[model samples]
Target: MVDGRRITRRRFLQDSARAASALALTAWGLEGARGTASAQELSFPVERGASLRVLRWSQFVTTDRPIFEQNAARFTQRTGVPVRVEYETWTDVQPKAAAAANVGSGPDIVIGFFDEPHLWADKLVPVTDLAQYLGRKYGGWFDVCPQYGYSPQRNAWIAIPIGAPGVAINYRVSWVREAGFDPDPARFPRTTDEFLRLCRALRARGHPTGFALGKAVGDGNTWVHWCLWAFGGRVLAPDNRTLTINSPETANALEYARALYETMIPGVAGWLDPHNNRAFLAGEISLTNNGISIYFAAKNDFPEIAQDMNHAVFPVGPVGRPTELHLFSQAYIFSYTRYPNAAKEFLRWIMEDTQYARWINGMLGYVSHPLRAYTNLTVWRSDPKALPFRDAVARMLPHSYAGRPGPEAARAMAEFVVVDMFADACTGRRSVRDAIRAAEDRLRRIYRS
Candidate 1:
């Protein structure tokens, strides 16, 4: 276990206030250099007769795709390079990107989830120049972005962190109040024990929470990682080489999972990414964790639910601070692409403040920006509901926190090692000791020295 004194309530609250507050765009005092300097400092020449194919994950909200395509069309019109954008279901992106990397031919660029570029760093083009330029132009990236974008093996940036459709606590306001807990972001439960009490109280009122336990690439792994790390459990030590998942801290987390699972709605054991969304929208679940997609859907269709829903960051655990894991997306160009220049330029064009701001505001903060300067965007401040999600990327612990991002971390996460370990304990499929031992064995093989 880690030193308990490492974090304190006073420190946590201080950090929470910083994260919850939306700082000004000029927070870095670079308001004058925002757009004009970027065009002058860096420019990629378009390759002749170049046509680009980009692969990205399918959209959760309908508006996201149209805005993306509109920006792509603008890129083509300005550069005379035709671009085609295709999407894969969230679960298929990693495997498909791996396959393309192995074959040396496919889409010129891929926008995939966290640490994926690390899994095939050698096969991807280094965007160090572009990444650094963006950082200087924007306020700079959040701390977690570099964990996904920079590859230690290559000593360069293998990907461009776009943004994260951050997962937050999605709860029904009335349900929380009925259970005698205030749903306000400031007044919500601050610790895991307090959170458990709220969950049990909700269950007693005939409303229960549900979190995915199945092989959900996004939701399942995200929450399970939070549960494990909440009590100071970590998959690997700081060296990124030592196996450290089986311990007293891990056992405590598993015991807590078992208790939390009891208060959840039935069949969470089989729940995938979409299950909780459906349940909550159907009024069968009183609380869950999700992106702004839930609120978006409710606003468009279920007005009453939209009015009643609220969001907050996950509760602090025994660790005395936030140890959250959210869905992060990054983009990478393939080494084998014929039009590397065209691909690079296209990426650069869309990430410019003009195009990026339009896309972000259109999506209404479904995807939290990785650049710190974006915290000042009107989208975050336009609606009170989106404010809780604005700094999620800034506050989250990336995959392999306390370690480094690499093929081992990516492979372990993709294989669902942590998710399954928590699932096994929560479902009573294995005793807590067995679950920890089994997870340790799997992690040992993955992180073999």
Candidate 2:
């Protein structure tokens, strides 16, 4: 155990992969759709003898896999196509995807996280027609959807965004109340300064907060990026050309980060994505930022904690409005797949309102929709605590914040440039100024290429 807490996988992943688990599309079926009317008639003939292998991140919520498998079974029973779905730890998905792209063989379809499609756009089959049809039929994509799925270089959609696993503040109501702060959403901290005060107050009561500072792929990146942008700090200018991370705003963010870090439970500097989740469930941390997984786990395993837990959106910072970052998952077909038509059809079938709604509802509020119409889904309002996550996509800023989307932003994030900057200062390895300067230098090398 690290820091007297057990390190373990989310229990859902253990049994989900073994659960029991579709459709063929003719090449012309997707291509023929010019509008919503034609889209309804889309019966992409499944390529004869087509079978698919799909790789996705492990389920963060318990019901996610069974419902997903049930949907796949429905697709197969209806369309006479077979599908095999596999799961990997989320952090491992990127390298496995890279291997698939490099060797031209692996899972036929990969459902992975943020900007992965951008990293290998040239090697994937374009789904622009399918994307367009879905857009017309399902209202329209969110503002950040195209930024991740549509490739500027290819002038097409290399991937389809499935949903975002919304991240927000998870805290114990009793601890928050005892710490002398109201636990109500409306009464929660509304500014970064107030947030720091809350953290400090919680610590004074022996219930310190925690946020990842290590090289965690999801949690680490989400919270750090939010902190950076919340104070108006950015890696590049609006043109996406000039390096601008060394400014006063960034220094302010780092100084603030250092203060927050002081109020955190010990050992956060080495905490990974799952660390805070474990600590929170173990009742070692009074507060932390995470997706809905923590609440579900507590609901099932520790009823007392679950009863006292509540969620809220991050407070507004110096930049003024909400500036949160969430992990977005998207699916793409490798060009080498022998069943491209079947792959396209499977994606389309699952994203259809019927199957998509079932899959999303099963996740409860764990996953937020990328399509605008899904904002009205019943799951968002299923529980009062789920309400904060309902607008994650709508409230989020894309990677690189004020700058454009491209490989530079993806590369910087993959390398943990932002997370490490905060780690450096908070851990006392570097002063706040040095940490900002180091981040600026690293970003310059990345954006210059």
Candidate 3:
């Protein structure tokens, strides 16, 4: 929690107003004049010789190289400064960053999933003064972008959210229709019981449900968290300092997950994240929990499947609330870099409405933006095929929750809790109750240590 003294409601409202003003100015074509003045106020004046070194995810850097390069070129055109990028995978990024922070030799900026903030907090330079910087530059920060990467305790901006991927139930429209069920939202599952009955009905017709049960990190972690949320359980307490998975809600969630497993495709227990995508592509599974990445993959690589693919919000639980929506808003910035201001400026540039749209459209379905301004852009809103995803984003954005934003919490989740108990529960090797208890125990030990 943030210290009450540092974040009074008066200050929050004031900052929000400034952010709104900045956004309005940007929309009104004051980019160069406004940004320059703002930049001057925030930093020691853009040194004509100043440059930036940034670290980013390899896949995005590679595929979107041209777009980013063009954006970089434009930035140079506008500000007479240059930006350099170094890219790596999440697996390789941490060790390299840790080594750099150890030796004081890291890049100025870093891009990573939500887990990155918690993993690299010590090295990070809090932009809690983000309002100050924004107030100086363009008059304010963009309202929506800040929600993606703020740490209340540190009272700082850790990273800037570039894009978001939201979780939903992906299903084969034709298969569901053939099963004599309407896949429309109005007819969607309203409770766990209804979801199970539907899954059974699909299986009885020979279309198996599938989930990521493989040993891979992505699939395994997603399945565990989604189930935890859907069952009214949580990975940790609201303060994000304790693992409370042993509650009745958590046990029930696990039981619900186990029930889904029973109707999953044959050998699904052996499937990993990639395999889940393959299973869906091969037409062996009718439904699964997935994100825009899979939907985009289908749309681009397998058009036929994409044509048949449709997504719906996760089912509600017996408790009357809907499934927990897990949203991954990819953020950028690394603390070890010598060029924090430059990196921040670059982030600010990309998050602008114009640049944001280009990045979103170029992702070809790999990314989703959560901001209402971006989603309502003419490109996404005007397209019929994009409507389902657009609507899903709108509906799920409000309820979305992220994992703990601290290194200890992240390590516990990645190394102990997610990898262990979730695997055990899905394979029927442990009951939901036992899994939650064990996870909570492990997490307690992690927190204490």
Judging by lDDT against the true structure, name the best candidate: 1
Any runs in candidate 1 off by more than 4 Å, and if so which?
1-40
Write the residue-wise lDDT of candidate 2 on 233-304 in tens digits: 888888879888888988888889999999999899899888999999999999999999999888889999
Ranking by TM-score: 1, 2, 3
Predicted candidate 1 versus true structure: per-residue lDDT over 1-449, tens digit per residue:
13656667888899777654433223322223234234246779998899999999999887999999999999999989999999999989988999999999899999998898988899988888788788878867787877788886887888888999989899999999999999897898989999999999999999999999988877888788888899999988888887889889999999999999988999998887888899999999999989999999999999999999999888988999899888999999999999989988988888888999998899889998998788888999899988988998899898797788889999888989998899999999999999999999998888883
In order of lDDT, best first, we have: 1, 2, 3
Model 2 accuracy (lDDT, Cα): 0.85
Please list the C-alpha lDDT of all candidates, in the order they appear.
Answer: 0.88, 0.85, 0.62
Pairs that clash in candidate 3: 38-136, 38-137, 107-337, 108-337, 110-333, 110-334, 118-407, 128-156, 214-271
lDDT of 1 at 436: 95
Candidate number achieving the greatest TM-score relative to the actual structure: 1
State the displacement of the C-alpha of residue 131, model 1, in Å, after optimal TM-score superposition.
Answer: 0.4
Model 3 has an lDDT value of 0.62
